[model samples]
Target: MKPSLQLKLSQHLTLTPQLQQSIRLLQLSTLELNQEIERFLLENPMLERDEPDGGEYASGPTPAAGSAQDGVNGSEQPSEQDNRDAAHEEQQGIDWSDTGSAPGASSTRDRDNDEEVDFQEFQPAETSLREHLDQQIALSQMCDRDRALARLVVEALDDDGYLHQTLEELLALVPAEHGVELEELEIALRQVQSLEPAGIAARSPQECLGLQLRAMPEDPVRKLALTIVEGHLELLAERNFARIKRLTGCDDDALRAAHALICSLDPHPGARHGSDDTRYVLPDVVVRKTRGRWTVGLNAEAMPRLRINQLYASILQQHRGQGGELPAQLQEARWLIKNVQQRFDTILRVAQAIVDQQRQFFDHGAVAMRPLTLREIADQLELHESTVSRVTTQKYMATPRGVFEFKYFFGSHVATDTGGAASSTAIRALIRQLVEAEDGKKPLSDAKIADLLGQQGIVVARRTIAKYRETMSIPPVSQRKTI
Candidate 1:
């Protein structure tokens, strides 16, 4: 064989600056995206938040396509030129409703307006549980060391107002403070528990319920209530109303009344104090199913409408003739603007491809999510596999079903008995349903679940079933056993 010169025509992907920018932007969380916008506004003299009554000068034709301001020192803006550019842009016309008038908007005018309202009006001062206890402790004339011990115990209480750790475990943390007798500590603990939210600072669910029941105004048949919470907690767990009547020495009528009272008691009194604050997840896409077709749209409201600064672009044009350092800065500015545009374009393309592929999922929910791979999507969109992965990584889409991370539509293929493949996500969902519907007295074990899956033609081992169950936070058969 002899070496011969050969010419081949093929396309390959290189990590271009534009692609890098797009990937970086695609993965930014909401907070990170806001920070990016702020950094851009600070560095670009031609970019400013449009202000109402700043007049026609405040917004300038929304800036032309490719215009972007060059930095003073490669990334810095010259103070004099920056001021002039900002003044010019301030005179530009814009519909205030477009950027302005949005709640929680980042604007100097908005900030100023917000500062005027008394914070106490709509926003109540939140008194944390620990702080509340501290206040009560401060008001008490307890000894210094006792106060310290009380604080430690209160801190140890979980979000549910139940102390998960044993008293001995807590004592170990502050052994030096063991000067206070365990009995005294117990007394202090009981006193703290008696404060507002009756069941708070309880050692267990039974104790929390008992505290609330003890706090109730009526005293008739109180002993029976206590007996039910203390001696017959198992009966309560199993919802054994008949057994509860026998155990509490109460007839059907009394048992019925006691059960109603028990339902009103707070099981996790401290949950509100240390519980998670409600977080709103805004989607990056909205998918709608109409006429048996799935439609997708980018959540435009969540995205910042960006454009190259026109005034800065003109200065860049002037700098090109002048030459020197200014020209370099102008080029840098152009690159930044181009990168921002490219980022949006790539994301839009990737998002559209995802919607097209997961149209079934959008129409019929996650169970209908077909087995999709990053390579397939990349090929469909004429992009590299890695590019597709990056674009889908942190991005999300909103569909008729709900908002889902773009990657949620993709999963590892589980080989089916019929030679076809199913999405692992779908299998996990099925496992969840099976476990939920399982008979409590005989909860399905991992092996039993695997057998069920086999019947569906999806061959998976017991360990694999266990792994999926663990991922769903379902406990093992022993732990799931009912009372």
Candidate 2:
């Protein structure tokens, strides 16, 4: 084969540094963006908050042609009236009052005049969950290896205090400093269960309930409750009181007592500690209900005060006057500031896009949730689907329905009997509501519910209805049917 070389000219898109920073900031959750800002402040000497040079109103290129009101700038003067009006504007979904304010202060005068700015207080709790468990372990009589293994097991437990991971998996995760086998890990787990919360380290809901029942001081009803949890949880979940009564060979009074005992056990023992310890929700948007109408706004409170560093800008201005040479370092500093500003701009744009798409969710809650997808959002905003996905993933909005993940608005479409479509999420929500309100003595069958939904214009097949029902942990028709 003859070797040939050819040259052709073609254009391809390349991400500029500023564009890349914008994309990166757009993808970060609000908490993550705050952290990124903090890290940038620590590393960049040129970027900072400062008193405005003068109490003068200045004009620049306006915010990107957005739907928000056009006149607001970053440097508005702060006053009681300004605060009240700003709050009112925010509630009305108007753009923030964006006169040239110093990064931390609403205006230059406020920055120059005020010495103290009110900061959000971080109130620390008395004792953390891990600390509470450690204290219990310390007061116990377990040996060092046992304590070590128990610590691994306890740590392996999820926020609900259920050991979702297997003993083998936990054994693998534990360091060799513990030098424990799976059997030893299991044994240590059992000992951890002996702590104050009787079922803290159990592997499943049934197991947790069983452990709690076993720890009771030999009440006859406790044994019956343990029997139900250990072997008849499916029956109990379906509210099959008759089958449970028959199988346990308990009379009505005894079964009632046992059922009462079963009800007392915690389904989620560790839920009290809070679920998202790793990430906090700083809602990027807020939706309010005003006189039966829904109003939405970008949460200005959650946004950090950002402005061009006046001190650095002044220094750059002075250096410009010297007129000898523009330093390479100064150019780099300018690039950084531009990138940060672009980042915030992108975030604001993306936030607006999300609010626009999910406005219905804000108005009517989950039941009225409309179908949305990343591709749809991306197409609307002229951005990539991946960019939309990343923006929505960990982000949250404080809506009239309360705070929800931004991604919650997106759901798969399911065909309805009316030839229209509904979000699968909405159907699931409907099924949950139906199941919650079902009569325990005669629980609704999936097939019956499917028929009922069809009558209401949602055309779900019996099997499809069953699948969604089971996904929600609701059992089969046979399991749900009463005696």
Model 1, global lDDT: 0.71
lDDT of 1 by residue, 455-482 (tens): 9898998999999889989988865644
The backbone clash count of each candidate, in order, is: 14, 9
Off by over 4 Å in 2: 1-8, 50-195, 199-211, 214-220, 226-243, 266-278, 289-293, 320-360, 375-387, 470-483
Candidate 2: 10-residue stretch with minimal lDDT: 54-63
Per-residue CA lDDT of model 2 for 1-483, tens digit only, reads: 999999999999998876677677777777777788777667665444322442221222222322132222455558998798678766887544555543345666676545565443445655645667888998899888788877887787777788778877777776887566778976888888887677787778888898888888997888888888899999888777777877888987887788889889887767665544564567776766668655556666565544444445445566775633334434444555555455445555666666676666666666767677888878888978887777777777786567888677788888876678888778888888887788766778888788778887888888888888878797775665543
In candidate 2, the residue pairs with backbone N, CA or C atoms under 3 Å apart (3 or more residues apart, or in different chains) clash, namely: 72-98, 73-98, 73-99, 74-98, 74-101, 75-99, 75-100, 75-101, 76-99
How close is each model in CA RMSD to the real structure? Answer: 10.2, 12.1
Best by TM-score: 1
User: What's model 1's TM-score?
Assistant: 0.66
Candidate 1 stretches greater than 4 Å from native: 1-20, 46-121, 136-185, 203-213, 216-268, 275-279, 312-330, 436-443, 477-483
Q: Candidate 2's error at 351, in angstroms?
A: 4.9
